[model samples]
Target chain A: MQRPYNFSAGPAAMPVEVLQQAAAEMLDWHGSGMSVMEMSHRGKEFMSIIETAEADLRELLAVPPNFRILFMQGGGLGENAIVPLNLSRGGVVDFVVTGSWSQKSFKEARKFCDPHLAASNEADCHTRLPAPGSWQLSPDAQYVHLCSNETIHGVELHELPDLKALGSNAPLVIDFSSHVASRTVDWRRVGLAFGGAQKNLGPAGVTLVVVREDLLGHALSICPSAFDYKTVADNGSMYNTPPTYGIYMAGLTFQWLKRQSEGNLRGIAAMEHRNMAKAELLYGFIDQSSFYVNKVATDCRSRMNVPFFLRDESRNEAFLAGAKAAGLLQLKGHKSVGGMRASLYNAMPLEGVQALVAYMRDFEQKLA
Target chain B: MQRPYNFSAGPAAMPVEVLQQAAAEMLDWHGSGMSVMEMSHRGKEFMSIIETAEADLRELLAVPPNFRILFMQGGGLGENAIVPLNLSRGGVVDFVVTGSWSQKSFKEARKFCDPHLAASNEADCHTRLPAPGSWQLSPDAQYVHLCSNETIHGVELHELPDLKALGSNAPLVIDFSSHVASRTVDWRRVGLAFGGAQKNLGPAGVTLVVVREDLLGHALSICPSAFDYKTVADNGSMYNTPPTYGIYMAGLTFQWLKRQSEGNLRGIAAMEHRNMAKAELLYGFIDQSSFYVNKVATDCRSRMNVPFFLRDESRNEAFLAGAKAAGLLQLKGHKSVGGMRASLYNAMPLEGVQALVAYMRDFEQKLA
Candidate 1:
């Protein structure tokens, strides 16, 4: 059966191969006589699963030796509180609010620490980035937080700001939920990076936290042991079960990632190239057409989530129905922002985007 | 192929029917073109899934009208601190320490509030529960905490203690991870109950929180919004993106539970009967033999997790291998307490228990 191209913002479409492999191994994983979900986290079979997953993710992302990868529960929202609980120590923290996610992070952190909005783009409907030069760096801030990619608003940070270069000694924390693994991470400028695995990784319920070695043991006394980054890192994410099945599927994805090749690039490098092509295919058609428009600035637009509005709003439901009939799914934008969002994650092949663009043109011609 | 009778404490074995249903629905759920994992949590499809799962569980447990069921992330370990974060209010709280899980709970709760040990069975290596009448209840205690079943020590509170009857005005909180769904809960005696789904329910990532309506709004300022019961309950477990696939599998298990019928009993009523029989089979066999022993008192022995020691400890490895060859898996006890634990949850059939007992007898005969 031909499945529609799933464009969900999260718990999103996984690679077809990953799903197939997972389904094949649903009852027994590699002759272990138990599904990965059924194996004890401490058992050797599951230990190997977690270890290989962590290793592959480290390799795919080129994670630094000085950083630790901890698999945790609680998606990005849970981390909004967990991050502050672990790092704040009741000190002031600065935030550069780019879009909804970082804005939510700042608000949630206020309950645990003194959160100061160092910069924001709410004045412009979050279409552009706040110039980094204008950020007010707090001298005593525990960390400066930002969302590298805004899943809802379709804003992406093409380059990370080095806090040291900005004359701030605080470690930079980025919520890279939507665009993780689609592009390279500048780890040197980051103290901690966290993302829910749903969007670009494998599934929900598994959260990935990459924290610098120096930031390890400063969790406040009130931090939950399972959410405590230090405890999780120390226990190898077995601090509490570690979402065994999700890790196994993600491990399969990482293995798939390692084998992804495009042009002169391979692995994540190849994935980034293919993602760029897919985004170019969809956005180029939108830019050249009179019937559709993308509001985000060219330089700051997200490659993963592309939100576009139809020239005639009355055609929305009809367009969605036609899109569904044509084998496209979950393209509806977030409720807070009404439009259409085509999230072309690492899983959406270039052909899928080409088909979408072709359908859009044919539909536009019919409307004309 | 015949599957093994797995005995891992948690991330434990599930009902085979649940696995089959999950596999069948791996691509499409009902007539929806998306897998449950692919559905938006707010969308109609996933909402129906959550509502059905909640309703089935409510029916199975006979939960009262005033209780709110919250499907959350972070396992029991996360709840160790989350419970105090939400209920402790930085006020005095009393804990009845019985075994490893409760001891960990007490230690983590100390980080959030002044958690005093009102009673303890540590003096007897957690072999017995302290007499309820002897506990020195704190007058201003926020709540009195206890593990209804100590998964590690194989001890259970066959009868829940009533705080009012014991001269305490505080509410009672129970962690019922290893035995939830296998028996019934007395909601009149519980203020809040939480457990990870890996054991009796479904998978590792989903944590079930059933809180009293009156206990909703008292979370400390230090609580993360995601872990805060009020925020979670109000949003219908979508304050954050939930573990979608985990919820789907749990929903399947709930259906399995609801359809269960044995003799004149049905559903959870039937589950309790089968659990009693399974526990009796294994324990009765162990009791009749000189080669094995279970230390917990017969009145307090866990119907779900039965921890037993071989008469000769030197043959432990050989016993495990023999059991594995006989299609009984993961019978080894927790590393902290070296012995064998056979957790016969709702998922384990009486025949599985009989198979385990037969294997145990065969191994003992061979050793002789």
Candidate 2:
């Protein structure tokens, strides 16, 4: 049976094969006589599962040797506070706000440190990115924060900026919740990168944190020990029970990623190539059509989340109802930003985007 | 096929039925065309899931209208810091350290509040609980904390102490991680009760917090908003994308708990009766056998986790190997406490305990 294509921003679609394998092994994982969910976190079975998951994720991302991959609970929003708690050290922190998520991070960090607005695309209504060279870097800033992809506003930083070249020696922190694994990350420019697994990873429960080695052990005294990077790293993210099932599912996803191939590309590279195609297909059609439009700047448009508006806003409900009828789901835009959004995450195949574009054309012609 | 009996301390064994149901619905939950893991937390499908789960759990626990049930991430250890950050107000908070879990809570709480040890079992090696009468309650203490069941030390507080009767009106905070659903809680005496779902509920990603309404809002400035009880309660734990799949699995476990029956008893009461029977059978055999011994005080011995040691210390490895061969897994005790621990959680059938006893008898005979 064909599954409906899902376009929700997060807790989104997973690879069908990964879900099937998880279902098949839910009762007894590799004849261990226990589901991955039922294994003790400290037991050899689960320890091996977590270790392999971390290692596979490392290989998939080519994470640097000095980076520590910490599997944690609480999504990107939770990390908003946890990051400042660990890195801010009650000092000045700079934020380059591109959209809603970075705005939230900046606001939340104010409770922990001196959060400075280094640059903001809010002046343009978050439809574009502020060039890195235009950013106002704090001379005493401990770190600079940005959201690489805004799931809601549909803006993405395709390339990470070199902070030293941008006249700041501070570490850069990126909230890559929506676009992680859909593309490559430049680790040399990143001090820490965190994302909720709900988008491109696997599920909602696990949050992935990859932090540079030197950034560890600097958590504020009030930081929850479970979320303390040094503590989490020291214990291999088992300082508390590390979202056992979520990690296992994400491991399956990492394995699925490894098996992916598109022409000469494989793994993350393959995903990036496919994601670009899917985004370009949908955006190309929208750009050509008179009935629908995406307003984000061409250079900063997100490949994962595509927010579009119909020329006549009265057709919004009808658009959603028709999309549902056409086996498309969750196309409604975020409540904060009214319209429609089609999130083309790593798992969303090119065929799904083609189907969406075809449906849009059909609807437009009918309306005309 | 017969599944092996598991005896791990936590992230322990679950009911075979729960695993089977989860597997069956993994790809498509109730024809929603989405796995529970993939459902948007705010979408109708997941809202129904969380609401039903909360309702069923409230029904099972007989939670009062004045108390709010929160589904959160961050296990019990995370709560160690969160509880104080929300409740302590940086004031003098009292702790009754029964064992390792409570001791850790006390230590973590010191970061957020002036933690005062009102009572401690450490001098006695955590083998017994310090009586309520012996506790030195502080006049200005904000709350008194204790682990109702020490998962590591195999001790339990069968009944919570009334702080009011002891001349202190501080709310009683119980970490019931190891035995939450095994029996009913006296909500009147409990201002708050929190536990990680991995023990009796389901998976490791979700933490359950049932707090009195009056205890709602007063979090420290440094508290992460996601971990703030007021924010969590006000948003019905949707402040951050909750551990969606974990909540769903835990909902399944709650449903399983509701379906359970024991003669005239049902639900939590039924599990309590069955748990008592299982505990008595295992402890009875151990007490009668000269080959093994359990060191915890008889009155406070945990019905869920029974830690015992063979008199012959050199045979620990052989004992574990034999137990594994007999399809009893993870019987090895906590690293801090070297002994075999058989946890008889709600899911463990009486037959599993009988099988364990029979294995123990055979092992003793072989040693002889």
Candidate 3:
């Protein structure tokens, strides 16, 4: 028997092994006689859980020695304010409005800093990413904000832009919420990276923040102590009681990711290989079929979230119903962009994408 | 078999039934072929879970229609700063510092408002609550902050202070993290009530905020859109991607709490009755035993957390080791104030209290 593939962009699908382990240990974790949720954050049991989770994540991402990984509570939306509050210094900051997530970050940063438009792909209807060389980098910008993958727009920056090469001395802050761990990150090009854990990492409550140690301690006075990177780092994200159960779930996910293997690849490298194949399979089918059309540019199409529209929109309801019957779930796209989307996160197997493509193909043939 | 009676306090013990149900539904929830963690917050399945949870909570608490219930992230510590950011209006806010939690809230509020220490029990080592008559009511205060139950010091406000009788119009804001849903609330006297869901609720990530409708739209400009009470209320706590799993776990716990019964009482009334019995059982044992002592004044002792000390501190290790061996776990006191502490949350059955009493009796006999 197979479980239906869930395609939620976030609070997204999780690996079956992770879910199995979580279910198996739901009552007691490692013979501790208490569930992960029941353990105090300050207790040795929970401390080990969080510490191991951090170490595993750091290893999984090959996080630099200078970087500190924090397990925080608020999602990517909360980090919009937190990032500016910590890094912006109430000074000029550059924003590349690539899509909805970055656009929201740019807008939210306005309250705390002077967010200057570095570049925008809005003119292209966010179907493409602005060329890195075209950004009007701010001379005195505290940081440059970008969403590495725009979940809604189905656009992703395959490679991070090097700020120093672009004549900006500022740090590059990326919100990689939808696509974190799907591919390797180039630390040299990134000063800080944050993501909500729902999509690729684990669950929704936990937000992962990996920042260069040098970027710490410059938080604005108004920044809440719990949200202050320095405070969180200082206390190891236990400044406030952390999301214990969520961290435990993420730890299980990290372990599962660690066990993943591909031909000549392991861990994140394997995930990247698998994700690339899944994306190619889905996007390849969509590009070839006359019934389907993906609006995003070829180079910028997100490997995680692939949004597409049916040529005949009237058949959308019947298509979705048939897909459900075929065990393909949550094919409905975001309301902001009314169509269909299939998120191929780290937990999404190639077989799931194959099934989706098959379902789409069947639906299209039935129409003929 | 009875599991170890865990008493670490917040992120404390959950109802076994909730854990069992969560485990059963880990792979697929109600035949949706998706775990609660995997469901999109906007999806019908998750929406139903959250809605039903809210409805049940309102019925259990008898919350007024005028007060909006918000499922938020960031624990009580985060709310220390958030409460002021939303409600203070940069004006003076009166704080009654009874213990560590309120004291922390008062200091955090300093960044957003002129936080006035209207009262403090630190002089008494937080062993007693300052009378309402003694509180210096700030004439132009925005709100009055207090921790209804001091988890660490084991002091609780048995009855809410009537600010009107005390000659103040400022709405009372209570941090009920350690005691929420364990007992009833008098909403008429409270303008806002916030608590981390780790204790009486379910998990660590979700924070519960119940605020009067009139208090909406007052967030400071610097408030993060996700943290803004108005924005969160408007979007129904989906302003940012909420802690979906935490909320689901809490929903499960809420359902479990709703099924509680004690004699003629049900729900919160049942919990209050059970909690009172558990507290009495432990406190009564401690008070009668010459070897053990609880410092807090009897009239103000916390019904949830009972902090006690042995006359001979040298036997602390032995006492703790014996307790753990006897299936009593996490009875160690907080590092800031050490000795021993037992938290009897709603899930802590009276039998668990009896076992603790039995352990204490046997330990005291060894000394004789």
**Each candidate's lDDT (Cα)?**
0.90, 0.94, 0.94
Give all TM-scores, in the order shown: 0.98, 0.99, 0.99
lDDT of 2 by residue, B1-368 (tens): 78999988889899999999999999889988888887778899999999999999999999999999999989999999999999999999999999999999999998999999899999889999999999999999989998999999999999989899999989999999999999989998999999999989999999999999898888898888899999998898999998899999999999999999989898999999999999999999999999999999999999999999999989999999989989999999888999789999998999999999999999999878
Query: Candidate 3 chain B — worst ten consecutive residues by lDDT sum?
Result: B1-10
TM-score for chain B in model 2: 0.99
TM-score of chain B of 3: 0.99
Count of backbone clashes, every candidate in sequence? 0, 0, 0
CAPRI grade, predicted model 1:
medium
lDDT of 2 at A302: 98
Instruction: State the iRMSD of every prediction, in order shown.
Output: 1.1, 0.8, 0.7
After superposition, candidate 3 runs with Cα above 4 Å error: none
Backbone clashes, candidate 2: 0
lDDT of 3 by residue, B272-358 (tens): 999998999899999998999999999999999999999999999999999999999999999899999999999899999999999
Per-residue lDDT over A12-116 for candidate 3, one digit per residue giving the tens place of the 0 to 100 score: 999999999999999999999999999989988999999999999999999999999999988999999999999999999999999999999999999999999
| DockQ class, candidate 2 | high
